[model samples]
Target chain A: MTRGFPVGEFQARLARAQDKLANRELAALLLTTEPEIRYFTGFLTRFWESPSRPWFLVVPAQGKPIAVIPSIGAALMAQTWVEDIRTWRAPNPTDDGASLLSDTLNEVAGNGQIGIPSGPETYVRVPQADWQRIKAATKGDIQSDGGITATLRAVKSSAEIEKIATACDIAGRAFARVPEIASEGISLAQVFRNFQGLLLDEGADWVPYLAGGAGPDGYADVISPATERPLADGDVLMLDTGAVFDGYFCDFDRNFAVRTASATARDAQARLIDAVDRAADIARPGTTALELFHAMDRVVTGGAGGSDSGRLGHGLGMQLTEGLSLIPNDHTELQPGMVITLEPGIETGPGRMMVHEENIVITEHGCRFLSPRAGAELEVMR
Target chain B: MTRGFPVGEFQARLARAQDKLANRELAALLLTTEPEIRYFTGFLTRFWESPSRPWFLVVPAQGKPIAVIPSIGAALMAQTWVEDIRTWRAPNPTDDGASLLSDTLNEVAGNGQIGIPSGPETYVRVPQADWQRIKAATKGDIQSDGGITATLRAVKSSAEIEKIATACDIAGRAFARVPEIASEGISLAQVFRNFQGLLLDEGADWVPYLAGGAGPDGYADVISPATERPLADGDVLMLDTGAVFDGYFCDFDRNFAVRTASATARDAQARLIDAVDRAADIARPGTTALELFHAMDRVVTGGAGGSDSGRLGHGLGMQLTEGLSLIPNDHTELQPGMVITLEPGIETGPGRMMVHEENIVITEHGCRFLSPRAGAELEVMR
Candidate 1:
């Protein structure tokens, strides 16, 4: 309805990438990754296909960025902010694309060091041939540099936060409508359809992700909807949805009792919700991501009677799970404008898991909740 | 729902991949691409985030394949035919996933030539860094053989053909329901939800792709679904859906005129349907893919008054648009058991395009329409 989010959002991301390149003293930052490319160039060229020839968004230390894409997708890229679009036709060697990309990098960087995020941990796109091509093209030394982009994307802008909040609202509303649209004899596909319908009605720009399972025990790994699994009495329905609004995403889920509630399920839901609440209470800009994990973990393990459900939750925005997770190894400090999700649950056993997820945007002081609905157990019947 | 087609269906695919490796004279094939990985190992890993860490399924020259995936996804891989499963925990670098993958590829191929479809034409899943690690670990040369896997995948097995045919049936039925469900008042998203619901109800393992658009001129690109556009009078509704069943996909589309149908739309639809009919008639075993292209092209262009719609159709199976296409350059010979789509359409003006798509399997003597429903004129509504 409303034209997709203002193009200004993409411009801001490009500017941020430029700033990162400047700060790193790198002449150019080559993005051989899909997410990085999507972040810099507001083009969705990486569809359902082979990404072996990693497309690049070459950010110069001081200048406009350039987009290197497949030749056929050039027309679509023309609609984006990256004015200079390079296209390589199919059946060509990655070496060909690499040579062109390398030439661009060499021209942009001159004698300065080129920042290439070709390290194992961060690089999953560039093939060996292309890597060799890039190496040959750059006159300067190449260094693995993913930190530049990661640091820029770690913080969310006001507009980005808004999109994330909107996504959370849509997901929450969809979850709430599940009970109204689903019944005891309903199949998982019906429930999925109902949720998808609500998502569309509410103006979800895209169904970024929809995965869930229904049973007496809550679903652990959310999956695509199917008709085989039917909701029955006392079935614990776990819905984990990642609906996108204007490219920004929010990951959230809700626990619903299909018929009469089970004492075990109800207890697990209450403890997990309360634990997440306590964790949120302690969440502040000064706290560390790991500390938040400990806070939420303590509640679920102690209150849920020795239930283990991994890390309670992680960062959410732009990505389903982004930088600075509520996991033990995450040492990043929470800052204002950083959006994240705090989800704590108990996976009682196989096919049985109770988890509640909520979106929170860190503020100058504590944090602000973006979820439209409060944390409470839900019950539905035919 | 019926349990998905037997595991034997997937085993046959692995067997085919092994045959490809032997013919190509490669010791083993390094599958870094998602579609090929799923085809060989039946392991479905969501590419929602950075799939940098390679999930390798090594099909040795002479034995069952082994998989090395992230420890978190080990259980999922075990549920498939992969005999050996190795997992490495996340967030580790030196002794992490890259090292594990490097070790595995080295052991599998060892001093022998390793087939790596790492090219500009190949879809990339391995990150630039992991690819470097693989290069470092391999004792022998990394051969860039692109079409080996595609050649095997292009030909469909009996089970694969059945799955594709079943998907076509589901898609056709969904389109049939559109006559009753779609109206001038419904939003594009609502129509999409209904289409997906019908497919899921008919028993789909997953409806991974559902995309369409509402425009005066027929919508050509089927990207993300933007459900905000409501159907209106004189509007042409274009529905292009790619339904995935048991990992195999069938991509097809149908056009309908919202409200009363116009003479231009009627004329265009009739010509496009005729072109498809003629194309199907000419499709025969031993015929080159280009012959089918010319047949469809002559009918559509010669009949629709000359507007090149680019592609007439392409091969369909595990991937949405697999192997060769009905495009000019494709010269692959049509063989029995290979299923393809005949999609011929024309867009004369904005809100005015008529395109028809249907699946056809190359038989021993000639082609058989896999999609049972015949092409029809645009549906008119008051």
Candidate 2:
């Protein structure tokens, strides 16, 4: 597969952003986060792991996005469609691209509204001090982009959907190999480590997110890191991974019993997959995310709200979780290109819960699973 | 190795922060970033990869830190020493813990000044909309933490140092096995993918950052993601990684020649190691980060100045790159227990460059390399 998007893909994305800008009468969008900058310019790099320097991309009203970044990134940014790349010797105790970014904003927009993605799940990815400096120096009114950024990114292109599907396939293959590394007496931490290795071996570029739990009947919560607790007979093991393939993530999980599967655990497993199916069946264009959540909530919680985890699942793509959430309040209509995770958690006991997730894309016909669909029966590991 | 820190380690950290809070007369510190929250509470998890929910930790002047986070994190937070854990059903379209966090802050700090880290390399990790709402609702005077957060984090404890050293050791082992995964005909992207697998085998909890390049003589830049370009016989390859172990990061890189090394690349490699050695020779409790930079710069760039990576290296611990930076302007004095990476870059030829990095920790006497030190000679791949 190609490393990054084609030039036309970026051009189409920019045209879409420009359309939003024209409609809103906004001058430009000042993007600071990785996904935002990358969505417009195809400037993908793992260097964002370092919080040392802040990178900025300004999408003007009617032109290609301009990159104002650390000088270290000039070469990589040059390879992308972003031509107006401004560089600075970063960790520059004084300015650190704040002035250059503000100047670029003024030059692009000039006394108009320079929008920034400022709704939920959108952070101004700059130093708090530097953000203040950039805001003070800018001639334009720096305000929230009014969901324009989120709206543009919510829907996925065909190419983006393919990448996400490929990621799901890679994770599916990795999940198939879990029994090789997991069994009774194997520590959960080792299973997690081996599962990540399996992801790399199965064509994942990297595994960004991996969290699960193993306990009798069910696990406590889905967000905790793997502990050294060894697997035992009748204990359930959950391995959720957000493995990436070309910057796209497949967020899903698989459950297995160590040696023997309990009737209650098996039933919960069946119900979890039923929830995913229930949600996917009605997840069509014009359907709301809240409705999908209700479909899953009905199966998992028996129409009793949901687990304390809040949302059942969420929008997924460039990030493990993004865009609209599968919550009661989120009324975002499902779009043809929108990809989401149907993650439903069910309480098996007083404090034990089982959560299952699957990746799917909303299509003209209906919702189609990107991930290899899981069966109701829980596999017992040797 | 232990999964999380002991209660005493967290207690000591809280005591240190309380001292800083008392001295500054700041009512409390509102921390949003992973490292900041993890430092005081021993609450470590890779769940922060998801941007769906906001997590907050309020460090009051006295008493245990209060955690105002999503209900999903309640179980994990309970595992830590933190007692006052407040939860909100997150993705709550109206308020994702904004009111709860502000209320917690007000209860802890009263109407006094609440601090948030605002200096260089410090970002307010909350979403922009939620941050504004929290600021608007808080009765306390919200402002920059002055430098209290940075000051407290710069100096590490014995346990923190040990974890960092362990991470360095894991990376060192992974680097040693590069020959097993890399060779003249293999693509750089494959090498990157395999190297991450090696890191997991070498005992890293996760490989968060891995960026490198392979080109004839030397790579153009160090921050670019690996391309599909195959490594040629005359290529010089560098693999930089920020591998984590128990939440501590070891930020370092190693250089390798594919089959054979060019004289220019060999010389650059030698100079980079010499620069690291020079920096370590004077990196003691009394030495400043500026002095260390000058030492390394004298050897790498002959005092002509460093590359665009900004600083040659910076402080390292809970995060990949954090706290003080090694630049001419940074005058922060080194203290015992301060972990840092001594990285130096040089122009091998016109547009080509090479960089080498080694993790080190300042001691009462001098700097000691935490990462298994690389020799002056570049290892040629088979």
Candidate 3:
């Protein structure tokens, strides 16, 4: 595996986006976030961890995308398929590529309707002061892209699916070795640390997001950082990881019974896996996200719906969570190439719950699992 | 050792920001980014890796800050020092905490001047459409915070400095063990993956940013990702990392020679370290950032100026690179408790440069090195 997609992959993405832009009557689509930029130009770098510089990619109605980036990144951008690369001495207080970006927007868009991805789950990465200046200088009318990019990004190509499958394969190998470092005596914090090491050893590029918890029944929530509390007997330990390989992510988790298991946890784990398979059974080309949500909700919650964490599963690829979400209100129609997670949560006790998640891609007739599926019975830790 | 600061630390930070807000006549300060929200409150989590939800924090003129966040984060936010935490079931496309945040802003600011950190190096994290709606719903006047929070954040607290020093210690140990993983015949990409594992093994909570290069005399750029090229004799391998421990960052790099060394690479290595030490000599309570840039720039470039990476060094703490930049144009004055990196780059050949970086803190008298100072001569890998 390598860092970026092939030249044809980006070109195919551009064609799909251009068709959508034309139908919406938008001249160009402006991208400010990392995944959005990388989706168009195949520009990948970990330097985005620093919020010091803002990068821009403008995809016109016809042609390759133009990159208005810092001078330090010109060499890397050259390696991509993008031809017209503009540079600036960045960290410039006066104009940090603002006017340059505005000029590029004017040249490509030409007073037409220029769109930015400003719908749900998206935010413009530029500063307000600079955004105001760029808006005034650009000849195009800047507004929302009406979810064009999000819709196009939800349907994965064969290469994109392959990258995501590679990421899933890496996480699957890491999860199989969890019992080696996680036992009754180790602390949850140490387990989290050692688990991350296992993911890297199994060939993950980086573990960007890792959150799990351990308790008698289940974890309180899914998003909290690890604590130093020691894992005790009868504890139900859950480890959820969004490990990346080749800039694609695999979002899934595994459950373990530390030194023991209760009847409630055993039943809950089995029900969670059953709910996931039930959802997969109805996951076809024309099914809506709401239908999948209800299929799993019936088994997990007795049709009561999800808990406070909101959605059960979400689309994952370049990010841990993206695009369509599985909830009662989300009615996004599933497509052939749409990759998503089927996560089902069961309330084991009063305030504790156990959640099971697996990655899958919807095929023409049904769906297939990307992650190595766990058994119905929870693994027992020594 | 812990995920967050003490209550006193957050209280002291709020008090300082309140004092500054009073001086500027701003009724309230709005914080949207992760670091800004975490600075005022000890709410730390790796959940920020997912851009699914937007979080907001409002600090009033006199009282504690108010959190308008998703219900998924309410439990974690409650553990912080904050008292007023407002929650809404998130991923709600209809509302998504916008109306609640606007109402909170209305109650606290109330048609008064509501300040947001919108100066250089700052960005508004909310979507433009949502921001417009929030702006219309609020009665307060919204504009820039006039660098109030940035100024306060630049000067670290005693607890903050201790966390950064611990992170530096972990990176120092990781760099010392590089020869075990990196040597002649080993690929650069393998070195990157194994080096990150070493950082984690040495107690780094996470390694967010890692970039370097290997070439005959020097590398072309410092920010590009690693390639598959194996190290050879006379290659100067540079590895820079911004590893984190308890949310504090240590930004520095180490250089090593593969098997054999040339006179040019050896001389450039010593000169780069000399440039770093020269800048540290004048780093005191009253010196300006420009003065530090000149001291290092003189030694590296012979008064010609720094390379296109923009600055010799920058402020690092919560974020990989933040706050002040050591450039000729940046005239921000250094003060006690200000932590920065002294990084100087020297061009050894055409389009090739080798840079040296060291983390330091300015005391009341002078500056002290936080990262272990590297030897004047480059280390030789077996």
Candidate 4:
């Protein structure tokens, strides 16, 4: 059921990975993170369980890459552009999988300095024994730098963009059905289930997340299920979904007017929605992320909105919320096919708040709205 | 709504953590990973949207711990035993929270070797610049060997056992309800929803996971959902649930006869179920994990009742599955109040599988069954 990314396109991605490693002066870069592995190798795995069985992709500065994976994953690994595959008995009964992976990494790294992304500065370290074994086996200094992979994955290709677009479409359609099921007297939990069911029915591999808050108070409140108290008339429902398709994710959130209407709520919602639209409008190739963020911020802060707010939006793809953020100093210029979200959310009071989010891809000339639904207006759900 | 484990008991757990750190020569451990943080400080955080903001508890060797969390979390931190709470504004319009976190960590470590739990060795690292800033700000050697935390968390407390038991009960109830709602006309997706709904109704903080195959070809597997294939008569329905109650999760699986009986499927199911039961019998206090595993292996591999196949089971708690797995050579002994699961699952073919799982808590004398409902025999829903 995994409609895998094209083989030729992935081969091209591997080539790009090789170039990145070479440019970074890395003899070899070991990929252990799922996103990094999927970025270069097109191999996706679930991380919900323990990673006792390590999957390390060795991208040498030169030559075809080798993937050291669990024996169970051998067949799946072969589907990737990576050709040289090494399989070790996973669940190694002897706790030897990590050591075996280290051995494989050492064999490929040889005396060349290998790069460890997230480097020595990371918080989570490998098992102490494994680290010692890897170091002992390798003669060269093990350098740490994940920049090579980060830079390579930061830019999106046409195929990757297509997946993001598809994910957005699925999410939008799922959202379009939310109002159909949500009604007075339904528990927030039930509504949550309905939203999730819609996403799954729409062929989403999985719904990354569905978080919401509701009540009559206002944005000043932290709305959780305990606040589940029920969606009464005039309740503002803030729902956010990070639905994934083909491993790519699209994040979308919208505040819905439930049963009742208030001028203040409508005005606030309009302003936030306008901010997101303005942000997307200013987003084009060559525009810096920070610049786009500021344009959105002006509408939010200047026009009756809360000063204390979360980031306007963020880059979305393999990970629902990617590492590359959308705050000041993030100089990653808008590029065609690189999809990002613009969410100007405001939590003014405990039970009052409004969030308007949209997914957009920077296009050749300007920008393309991945989410087909209208922006800058509240979608009243009665 | 936090089912708090008695605070006094956690004090003893902290003492145990201190003992491990002292033995390991770690000056003070910085708790970054959620499991480690929860083990040491009883702090809980959900999986992750992104690693943009680092939440950590600095457990000094000889002092009360300090919580370095995002500003909004300050109030929540105040509820914990730790009093030295430092807050970093979660990504404001212009600031990245990582900078503030690094500053706090550097200040706390102050020229001393700092031990970071679940740190860099695990492939998941702190942001590069954050690491650099910490190093630049102090002369302290920050090491990422979270072994102390791992060792501490591996052994469950009485309270932890209770929470796990609660989780297992929820999971069992979820599994038990499957037959009541599942029908030939219903899609596997709907079945999944019904199972999850039961878990939520039973007070699960979140529906951890529900994955199982639907059909009679044989091995009903556990994986992410794919096509919305409807169930059919004579299908072997395998249902596995990771239902969390009070932050602790119990992973349990069961096999049911969808509509009628197949002699082969029934026999296979019986054998697998018996193997799991025998394995649980051996999981008394002082029994090595390997011993329990061997017991199960002996029954399965010897073709007892025609079910000589599949690994025995593994440990379970906060994660659906984790810590000191019950595989061969894992010498960790069963201890009083330690919760674990025995799931001997056999998948003979596509949609043809038999699985029986149970949650057991080792007692001072032997063990107590926390999951009252056993899947030792096939449950026919014809």
Candidate 5:
């Protein structure tokens, strides 16, 4: 079986999903996105890159989840815990997967309501035309199930936490070798390539998201792709990576000075680290995401530097960024088994900024670090 | 500017889009997907990895596109050709860019209809709830614009083709060095890591998709991730990659024999190459995807072997797979300035198969190779 986790893990997940569906008085849950489908069946494949086809998974209120996917994925799905696998030759303009998906949903739900994720941070992977066709064919009310699914997915399993921790360790090992590959005179683009290579060499299944910037005092933004400009003395270089291991992601970054550091950059880095420490100290089973945001914002701004970045941090798991964002409006309560990132950013100058991030798993009393703790001061590369 | 292409390229694209919208009587076209937004405004950023916020671009019938996105992306979007960039602090539960996007659409569209891609191979990137909110708040009717957008994106510009060719060349260079990294004693997982590192070293901006399978005679599937199984003598290994260069992707793969090859595998490889050659010879501006599929299918099946793989080939450009698929049901005509991939898979045994792929750009007279041609014989790694 190519699926990474044991059958019990997927079974527990399905059970949780079914419980949520039952609690919401829904007959079944329709999952079309990659993360939702992979969560219940453990049917993992990189084939999702090709958008030519859409895969569907329907979880009933009482039984095991059924896979309604293309025939190309049958062999892999069979290796998972799913038993009732229905498939069709995909890219069929006449039928596609619409008929099969509709029939499957109708069989499970009959005339009852079917839940699907449709709220914030959720996207329906199936084409809108296909979704309309399915809706017209099936006799069921397709209600928004984002609240139910997000509540369940927010809590991670032990196996998932271990996988995330392993990914963090791999990234840490790669970041430790950045000094050997990055130095003055090396282009930031080349540095990105070398750093990504090091991440893969250290044991990441793949490096999906890598974005950073390099500037004299600090970077203007943290999301821009590396430019070909050569690194110079006194430049602050930041590299953030979302490396994967067994489908789990570790979202974090490390900062380094090319030859020397400005006092403003140093002070910003220290303040960001302090903010993370304060956030980590208050991250417990009962604190809300908004509360945690306030806890970090105090140290980051000190009533001066307001954050322009959307959120301070977010929940992390199957996707690079997941539920329960650390913003003022989000009231999602932190609970045990929830893995999240504490990312605090500070503005150093008019067009310069520094951001610090770390991954942690919330426990009964507090939180434990998944990623290795970064140093109090910024490290020098040359 | 951080935007990749010149203003003239984007202006041309906008002109094409406006012509399509005007012909369809659409007051404005709404784009939310990464590829769609980047295609129009050249607003390229890796921040799309985070799904916390939604980014929107609204193109009027006769003018430039307006961007209503997160404030965090204002700097990068400013670097693009888009002049009217509206900003908001994102991950805001109360109004997550909905009001801004709705207001922008209303300003341009009035009470007329707005177009959005809603057909096959198209996914709405925004949350369904937010989309509903926008539809309720705006005065325009949101209708399907997939046919228009797909038609515009199907044909590539000269600069786009060159980027894809460069990415292909980088992959070819990396594949040529496989013998030095892959051997009988090495695990397939390590081989994948080394191959991706080589692609980066060869100037590929990033490798988005790398999938393959290793078996005695041939692999059962082509989309499976590399396992830790050590390669033995007489095993056939296939590696397919989607490497990127300037947001353009090269989609192709290569097959290699570990030490010695089986007769069936060798014959299948030769036949696959022959199929590609036949398809390439017949490819021209007037041909159709169905014709190309038949051209390759005849060489692979020989009126005997039936194919289960959905499509023989698909269009490729900004995405790993896009636009028209070389399937019997699709009748999209090949046109000048269109780039596509010719992929043929042959079943060597009951459950084992080998597939070959190459990228080409359709020219005025005939098709020109964008990816370097593969050899008739399968390469041996020993």
Candidate 6:
């Protein structure tokens, strides 16, 4: 119970999930991933880092969630709003809570279909053998929830938005100090370490993801860990972070030029900013993710844009990245209270690219920035 | 790419995995988890943070692994020893690398059995729907590997052991500086942040898991994130971290007494140290994990010990925690080159507990400490 919102907030989320389940005529929804389980009940713990045990939460179509977890988590899960908790000693290869899960699902489903997430970006955390065992033991028709829970998790609540915004502000403060910490002759690895310390000092609960690269014009890839390569003049250093605050993440990055920048890098940075602005104008309730992607693409390529960096951006909350990716094929309708990142990347040269990202919350009219806007000119760290 | 061992290291690992597959008559091993994939090909990247895409590496019976991953990861994976990399635009709901994975598997296996991890402490990281689709597309017998890969991954090479030792040393240096960073009037959250900063400054690539608690006698649980509670006299504060170095983890914790310690707390600390000593004496190549557990249990409760913290310790490596739990039911025989943590816990009073942990590498004769041994008495911070 490190971070607990008002019980009413959890109740509202549970109601939303139950409504979705009812519409699908599903008897229950079985959640296994961290974000989905934490969405309904406030059972938060870093113990999920240990994959040794599987924790399960079953949301009945009508009532509250039932937690079938290891006894070690019983004390922590008891702190949550969940009441019906069944515990067992975990790491038990013979059973490993499968019987308890089956018994609980049987009691909850009552011959109706059970919905589990099996679609895009979702994985069943339970062991495959145990999942099969539980399926054989239970009597209900276990079917894919068709990403119902992910669709619900896409829209952030006010509290979640506040947490994510706080994370963004923390990372923003750290980014503002990049010039002082990153300089010539300092290895990129040392710079990465110093920046992570700054993020922690600025109030990030944890820095889960920090990836960047440094090169002459621009970096080759944005998802690389730092190397011992020292920063030199005319190098463009980009640092992207997914810093967490109270379990919510702000996915954004800032680029800094070592002493100087090339014209291509500066132009790419400006174009990325312009693309974000264009996307922001259309990022209102009822807009589809595809529409937002096209808006940004038009600005990035002067109406000839196509995909770069695989995805422009994606939904952000609870985890570093969540559902409703801002890609062309994703037609997820944006609504008020949905938090996302407007990230636009452009190729500066043949194998060199620059990416700019900003976190935002979709509003009734358009969008508001969570992370402070990057400068039009690339930051120079001399 | 960031931390590449000799290419022969990866070759040796692939050879071992292939040997395991051959023993089980599995034509190919499909790895989807971070540690497993990184183990065979040295394809290390923090891009695993985004669950949006599934990365697969197929280790055939007699050759190098084939990486069927998102196109965005192509550049980074190219840096690794992996050669045959197939890429696709991921998040493509129409396919999402399923067809590509099927084609690769079909090409590699050719009606032979494909092994996937499906036993305890393992989960398929791919989308359940996509896995089903791939299963339907491919003609191979996709069977549960039954912990085949995990067992192979449990034994570390000398190079791997060096990385773990380096991570342990980094955490040890940070723990040694705790007196300067944590004390009375500083909130536990601040202490967590400062200590994580210290870990980075010391040389940890990233600190993925840092959890602890402070209480009058001892903390109720050790898996909680830091809260805003301030340290005061007579409180026992503990910090456990899983800091990573070159993708290997050192899982250990240190205890500090604020100003003074109660007799109960002091006694509990002594018992935990004594239990660790007894367990260390028996932590050799031939002893089973259960026997090691019993050795520590005998000292903790005079032959009547029961569970206090779910597990005493577990296997530590690429992930925060892994296979081979030090529990009574786990009879996984300790072998030379296996690295594990010797964690001993005792209940000082109702709703209060203290646990001590250290990392070790099992050797041919006995075991050697990967982390500096904790002090005989809990360090007091004023």
TM-score of 5: 0.98
Error of 1 at B355 (Å): 4.0
Against the unseen true structure, what C-alpha lDDT does each candidate score?
A: 0.69, 0.89, 0.90, 0.66, 0.88, 0.88
Query: Can you write out model 3's per-residue Cα lDDT over A1-382, one digit (the tens) per residue?
Result: 6557779999899999999999989999999999999899988889888888889999999998999998888988898999999988788878989999999999899989999998876888887788889999999899999988888889998888998999899999989999999998899888888888888888887888888999997888888878889999999999999998878999999999998989989999999999998999999999999899999999988999777888888899889999888988988999999999998888888768899999999999999999999999988887
Give one digit per residue, the lDDT tens place, for model 2 in A84-114.
9999998888888899999888889999998
Q: Give a tens-digit lDDT track for model 4, residues B1-382.
A: 3366667766887777677677767667766655666766666544244544666677776767877766645644566687888775555424345556556656656677777654212333454455565556655687765566655666787778878877877777767677777877777766765666566666666654666666773543345452378878887777777766666878777777777868767777777767767876666788998788777666655733223222356667776656666666578888876777776656556434556677787888878888875644567887
RMSD values for the candidates in order, in angstroms, are 4.2, 1.2, 1.3, 4.3, 1.6, 1.5
Residue A47, candidate 1: C-alpha displacement in angstroms: 5.1
**For residues A92-205, could you state the per-residue lDDT of candidate 6 as single tens digits?**
767898999999999999799999999888899988889899999999999999778887888888888889889999999999999878999999999999999999999998
Task: Compare the candidates by DockQ and give the number of the best one.
Answer: 2
Cα lDDT of model 6 by residue, B1-382, tens digit: 2366999898777777777788899999998888888888887888898988888989898778999989898898899888899999877878889999999999999999999999877888988888899999998988898677888889999988999999999999999999988888889999999999999999999999998989888988887767898999999999999999988999999999999988888888888999999889989988998898888888776777458366677998988888799888888888999999999888878888888999999999999999999976878887
Q: How far out, in Å, is residue A4 in model 5?
A: 1.4
Better of 2 and 4 by DockQ: 2
TM-score of 2: 0.99
The residue ranges of model 6 lying beyond 4 angstroms of the native Cα positions read: A1-3, A303-305
Provide per-model DockQ scores: 0.28, 0.81, 0.72, 0.28, 0.74, 0.75
For model 2, residues B315-351, the per-residue Cα lDDT tens digits are 9888888888889998888999899989888888888
Better of 4 and 6 by lDDT: 6
Q: Once all C-alphas are superposed, what RMSD does model 4 give against the true structure?
A: 4.3
Cα lDDT over the full model 3: 0.90
Query: How far is A272's C-alpha from truth in model 4 (Å)?
Result: 0.5
Q: Give the TM-score of chain A in candidate 3.
A: 0.98
Candidate 5 clashes between residue pairs 3 or more apart in a chain or in different chains: none
TM-score of chain A of each: 0.88, 0.99, 0.98, 0.90, 0.97, 0.97
Score residue B266 of candidate 3 by CA lDDT.
93
Better of 2 and 5 by DockQ: 2
**CAPRI accuracy category, model 3:** medium
